[model samples]
Target: MATEKLDVEKSSVELSSSVSDINLYTLHEERAGRLVVDPEEAKIEFGEAIASKLKLSHDGTKVLWPQPTDSPNDPQNWSEGRKTLHLLIITLAAIVPDFDSGIGIASLFQLAAQYNTTTEEINNLTSNWSIFLLGPGGMIAVMLMRRYGRLPVLFWSQIFALGFLIGCTFAPDLNTFAAMRCLTAVFGTAPQVSGLYIVTDLYPFHRQARMVNLWTMGFIVSPFLSPFLFGFLVARENWRWSYGIGSMYGAVVCLLIAFFMEETKYDRGVKDVPEPQSGLRYRIETLVGITGFRMAKYRASWKEAVMSQLNIVWRPHILGILIFEGVLFGFGIGMNVTNAVFLGSPPPLGFDWTPYAIAGGYGTPIVATVMGELIGRYLNDWIMNKSIKRNNGVFEAENRLWACYLAVVLDVAGLVLLGASIQKHLSPAGLIFGWGIAQSGVMICTVAVYAYCNNCFPRYAGEVSALINMARTMGGFAVAYYQVPWAEKNGALQTFGCEAAIVAGLFFLIVPLLQVKGRSLRAKFSL
Candidate 1:
């Protein structure tokens, strides 16, 4: 990364050789061939350190880097082998909070007997642990992801989370125990934000659903399976074993990521058609002004970087959509998650500490994400093709709207049925079955929402997905906390009912919003 001098007027100045990977789309298709790059333009744009590879270019002003923008070796474009490995690592990392988060259900009755605490507090603690982690951890993970790269953030956060888990394993007091759970929440969720980006970076837009479906296994399956996984551990031993086991899994994944997952922060050499800038506008703009305006290559001031994200967060359009996406993702998760705890703790629904109910809560849905994703993939493809045919070989952004509509309807209906089943106070089978259907929304929305977001925002695609993930995480946190007092005041059965009502409202709103806002590829191409 060496700097070079560009002369204008009488003065010569050095500019940063570094360039962000904003043009993720242009790389040679990694599915079959070689990644080629042009260095002459590399020299013109970024000296050696910034441009890593060289391919020649003729134009003095306009330049190209022969190296594929989304090169396979680029950490973002990790191979299928490595992508699967990464998800495995994310799965193990997830097992920590996920297992410990709800595994406590098995011990709640025992704990209430021994520690003299109420079932309500123990249940609330578990639900809140899962919910609050989504928001708070995601908030912090956003900054961590921007600064450290995805793999690094996940590795370090898991290591810290494991440490917190170890502390929870032996906490002498409930306060200390709850504090440790919160700590685990803070670190355990960092991996989630990075994991989705890992999928996007490596896979093409069309193939992304399959990769995302695979990823949903970890996110959707892990939580559902965690309770059951913890149950068997609880049966063999004590609740401490549950905490200790997931923590051990965490430590192992942390080590594996540190050893295998390469740092994805390398230069991809693809960039956007920069907003019209005076020659001076090309100067590096960090948080504040353009970097080269007064100085050589400029780094964003820390304050500026922080404020940049804040600015994005505050933009009216960004904020509105963020809220919409958050509600879409968070609603099903909050409803099913909070309701699952009712499987135990409540009498008539009681167990002799059997692992069956808890296991059922988390285990059935492993296939839900896989199944939903598999189905959504076909439906999404079918809809895209149908729209193109209807448009006479042209596609509209709104072409993707059908996927969103179908997913939301699936989710809302699932929640209302699950709520009704829970309110009916049926057998373990009815509740679990209803919940299983509700959980399918995770997979449906995962593909549909993501596909929609990617279609809508082509400019900063990775960050846009990351922002959506972050928003969803924050929404989960808010709704989870909201459910706590809500459960206390109204009870769990009613809380699910409330979620149903809210989602019913959201489903109606998103359809019209998309109708007005979305334009198909032809609509855009026509312009």
Candidate 2:
């Protein structure tokens, strides 16, 4: 989809501008290529050396010589089963680190009690996980999406995450456990890119918001079941079982991927191209990923593709979304996690698992999230369609962003209530009920904002998504360190309430028609 749109904008001059990976730039007509070229021509004169090479679909879908004329290059044109496989692969790759975040916190007290260590030491594990999942991990993943196939990268990451989980299970010391968590964050976070990336790959540009929301649901699902499992295990078998369960779950997901998932990284409906050129070291690694330069018809060196990938990393829109989601979602969500700890602990604020963990997280918020996702997956499509029609069908990307209004409303309201609820330290039911609103509101934000960011780029969805994760992960990291201390110092109520109001206020200001001038107030998120 990206290549097709780009080719449309590519004047003859841009092709020369892209001349670096010249080898991959040219493709030979072969099996896929030949059949592609001759829709009506029964066995054209190539009689002897039935030339071999993949070709881009004609009508400019970014392939090489001898390709189909009408190929759409949109992943949606693939089989229904293929789409499902793509989503599954992403869920497998993306869900682990996220599940570990909120779920793992409950196990901290148990872990420290067993080792006779302090909670502060255990907190490092969260830091390591956060940094890898959203920071350096995201930056690294951006390269992989362009260099390696999306499916391969996603598949490998899940398998690696399984390995890390296993390592965590067998850890002899806190350091060892911490190390495994970090490693998993690096490898396992690959699929998170897929969540936003696939919307562009598989759906029509106008149809993207709902799909992005659906992927967020996949992410939300893992956490729904994760905390319960964590609390149950840590309370019964000790904290190690928490790691064991995650590892086992990851292993099962990896197997599912190996068996059912298909490689979606290929440019659907198009022949591959010679990638834009780049440096020597980058090319060498690209060769390995491009399969020893085996996919020669496309003429892309591992090096050129990497450069193309890097180009995406630096885009302002991608950076904006990553920063926005990573920080805002991370800030709000991370605060929710830490505050839950503070609010639930014994004291005038005496709280327990039944209300906090089970009722709030597992009950009200879970149900609300499910409802929100259903809206995202199904009803949201209808909303987008209506917006498009009202716009006279020009279909700017901003048309799809209105769903953010709901999220903004909930986020502000929840933050305000949460801030006040803390000082009140109400009964468990009262506290959790208010907290549930915050959790659900954040999920709403995650679903809508994520869709908005990913859809911002019809092309380079993977890169855009990667940037978003980086920002979100970094935000979570900052929150992991600062939110609680800030809340504690600032009259927990005063500071949190004020921050919540600010976020809500900002969301309202940005929630209008999606752009100011040509600049796009939401940046490139203009429908």
Candidate 3:
């Protein structure tokens, strides 16, 4: 009887050891540097002893990234409904800045006339300035976010943004209005930068691409949607009405954020932190910025915060993505800013489209954006999943670059079509179709690059967000300065054709370089 009992114990011990041998969770830290994981190896049989040792996805097929603790306060552990609500609120907030910036697009002529300035001057002083400020604003916001916490910085910044926007609605001169516009952009950038942080906070790696696509839809769609809706409004009412209505929208966003958005600044690194409070205390602390103050000791110092943003730019993959994404995104911005001028200018110089027609035409990009979102929502994940499976469940960040090939083709074709159609004064349908195609490419490019950068440097998520925002805004800033003059001087065909060639050449050169050598570059310059 004793011998039989011992034999049973030995069998049980061997089974447990075998199950443990298949456990990939122990290798997470070692493989994290390369973002390489074997999800198949991570799978554990139901009721295995090792199963209790790690957190798995809902289906129990893979281990979760940035593993959540047992505490319900972890954003990763939040209920689905709560997470969805938070995402919705963040999405809405993210739309406000660019939406406000774009509201002026349809009213540029009226704005210039009212302020006794040329449209070029108005574009330079207000629109271009505001766009340029977005990059610096994101940098400052992220610095504060690192030290002060996400919710506080976002809440307070939006409050100030609302104030500045109201000033924009009432400014009496071009100088005042331009100043207000710049200030609004500076304050409004919080949501744009914070959107990435919150998404990273709430979702694991496998789930981030889809959430990012959803969040990015809001960001990408807002600039176009504002012009479409407000184009009609400006036609019917005074141009100031657009800003007035924008202020009202800002008020609604503020209310949603104050009431619903929770503090997502939980430190997964700190093991000894106290459990978070519930109900009113949590609400007040987060809303008033006290939560950030309380936790500041564990956060990065001011010097470290500033340096972190600068240091991220030094990484090879990050630098490559910044330049690549920036240039493509710049062309998209150049097109958007130039579209109204191209279609609305008088006589032989332009299409002479009515405000209502321009508004309707904006729908082309809107539909294209939605289509891109729908495709990217699945496509990004599909690409990542396939790459993982093909590599025995190890995901390489460079794999994300494959999607950019499609973006390159769409962008080049769209730019060529847009340039030719405009230069030849082709039908409005041709121009709109080209615009839609280019806009779709922008959507795809933004998502793919964002996912790739984040995957490359998950620990530096905040800095990554800031740097990406900076690259995008600054690139647009430079292009907006030259797009109109270049188009007018060189003809739209030559200008856009050149732009398309740049996009193609840049992508073909940079993307392949990253794919073939990105891992080595990252390993060589690990930031």
lDDT (10s digit) by residue, model 3, range 1-527: 99999999999999788766643322333343354334445433334465456676888755687677677988999999999998999999989988989987978888988988888888888888888898899889999999888898989989999999999999999889999999999999888888888998899888998999988888888888888999999888899999999999999999988998888877766646766788898788878798788888887888998899778797777897798898898888777777888888864557889989888888888898899898888889899889888877567888888889888888889999998888889988889889999989999989998888888777677788888888888888888788778878878889889989988888887899999998898777765
Find the number of clashing residue pairs for candidate 3.
0
List where candidate 3 sits over 4 angstroms from the true fold: 1-33, 36-40, 43-52
lDDT of 1 by residue, 317-356 (tens): 3455567668766765565455544555354333222455
lDDT of 2 by residue, 377-413 (tens): 7546766556545644323444445666666666666
**Residue 229, candidate 2: how far off, in angstroms?**
2.2
Q: Global lDDT for candidate 3?
A: 0.84
TM-score, every prediction = 0.72, 0.75, 0.93
Query: Between 1 and 3, whose lDDT is larger?
Result: 3
TM-score (C-alpha) between model 2 and the true structure: 0.75
Q: Weakest 10 consecutive residues, lDDT, candidate 3? A: 23-32
**How does residue 190 of candidate 2 score in lDDT?**
69
Query: By TM-score, highest first, what's the ranking?
Result: 3, 2, 1
